[model samples]
Target: MAVIDNIHERILATGIAEAGALLDRLGAPGDPLWPSPTWIPMRFDRPLAVGADGGHGPVRYHVTAYEPGRRVEFTFHPRIGLTGTHTAEILPHGPGSCVLRHRLVATSTGKMRLLWPALVRVCHDTVVEHLLDNAEHAVTGTVARPVRYPWRARLAVATESVRLRAVPVPENARLLKAALPHPDLADAYAVRVPPGTSLDPQTWADAIFRNPPPAVTALLRLRNALVAPFGIDRGDASAFDTVARTDRELLLGTDAGHLDFRASILVEPDDDGTTITLSTHATARNRSGRGYLAVVGLFHPPIVRAMARRAARAAVAPRPQASRKVSATR
Candidate 1:
């Protein structure tokens, strides 16, 4: 068994009551503090209370105590072999100031003993620090310095993102699904859109095509060169025509001598987080088209998945701050 005890705290230049108010809204909609859309959000089956049950991402816990605006405690689910409680509280400091603290006390049993220090601990520490940053930002409107994910933590996140399962073309992707009653090939891939991401499908589509990896660009150039002699369409962005569009979905396609294809980018928002789906429909018009499909199909899924992941990451990345011009005084 491995014992785990972790604590993170921040001193805000605000009264205890003011800091406590931030605590009270922990899992509420448009939450100002749990560091969501960047990290998985904290959620509960219902409004936060003593019996409310939920946890962010893979961790599972249930609320065991609530002190209104001052504090809240959660007990871990036993199935994971994690045993203990975690608490978040606001403590009064000097005049017009208070400290917000989060502490976790737990023991890891079974396989978790090995996993805790190697992987879980890094992610947990990073998450807690981000939470503290959010708390400080909420009270003071800025964080002196925000925590950044270390390379290992970033690797873990990227690994997890690549594992997201392929889902069916959403019903909301009406344009793509309706593009052809019988397409020879239909493929869809999805990724979770972080909180505060642009809701426009156009924005995501642009992100997907913008700044592709050098390897991808090189491969595309090779493909275009190889197909040019066959009298095949280059299938570049310039060849695609907008088939249809809505705030939630953008459909683009191209028609060539051997085949026709449509691609849809859809953004669907729900209670937890937004989902972005990329769906494609292609119809073969001849033997050459069928052969082309057979060859390209092998690479289609991974390419779409990579593009979706890239777009999702772009959506959450912080925008560059605008520079201010200095004035010359007389």
Candidate 2:
């Protein structure tokens, strides 16, 4: 009920507008989670707390700050009435960067002494910094995948009418992998999706190689497609830019300037098939050069996930084998 307002940093960035749009996804309305689409929802990452009390503890949070492209704040509302406030802010500056700040304020009522390190950090500057760098990537007409949410935060994956995951994968490892050597096409992200719901290996390969779905195009927007939100919605400088390099990495630049993201694809074989990991990273040199800018990663784990499920769906679905023909080669 009381008022608490503060500004964390200055503003600049030629790509501020695009950065704001990305943040808008987090607070967009009518999505099952967040009360509003433009704010942090309560159920965002509650499951990560399971290991704390043998999987039986009160976990609740309320949004105290919800502003598009600026700040997001939340308060802890424990069923047992524990006291504390969690505050978070995303301050965007210049044309291609933003600063992220997170603070926790907790007061004990009676004898609640400190236990853990007051607060712990799973993600912060590293994640948001990646977002800002990708904004520049967006501007240069390149696609850079943001680190996936660790398995713990991932929570669940929904496909039509099914959810999978017997046991949870760790939070830190789930979303963040070491910088992969190359961009991940279909074969690279198999591990990131559900085990085996509906996506087929063959179909998956064709999808990325022949016609990739959302995440593929989202990651490879440099190729140019109307379906890409960041690529198509961006300015002509980024949209029309040609891929200067196509091996080891993809280099993108615009007549206005150079875009700040690059990614490559790496492949490795497994006992059954393969495990592809796509890791995308970004950079911000000077914030003041481009006008104020904000950053957001258009994240859709389940959506990126469905592509995998679709492969499983295709694999198990009825298929005609009579049409199969063999070449004359013995």
Q: Per-residue lDDT of 117-200 in model 1, one digit per residue for the tens?
A: 888878777777777777777777667666667676676656543334598777888988787758999878888755667788
lDDT of 2 by residue, 1-330 (tens): 222222222222435455555444442232221211111222343222211121111335656556665555566664424466554455655457664444556544322233222311222222233333344344444323333333322221122112222222222222222322221211123332212222232233343334446665565554335324333224333432334322222223232222343322222332222333332333332442122112223343444355444543343232212222211100
Give the poorly placed runs of model 1, Cα more than 4 Å off: 159-163, 285-288, 316-330
Best by lDDT: 1
- Cα error, residue 3 of model 1, in Å, equals 3.4
In lDDT terms, how accurate is model 1?
0.77
Residue 83 of model 1 has an lDDT of: 91
User: What do the candidate models score in CA lDDT, each in turn?
Assistant: 0.77, 0.33
Report residue 122 deviation for candidate 1 (angstroms): 1.1
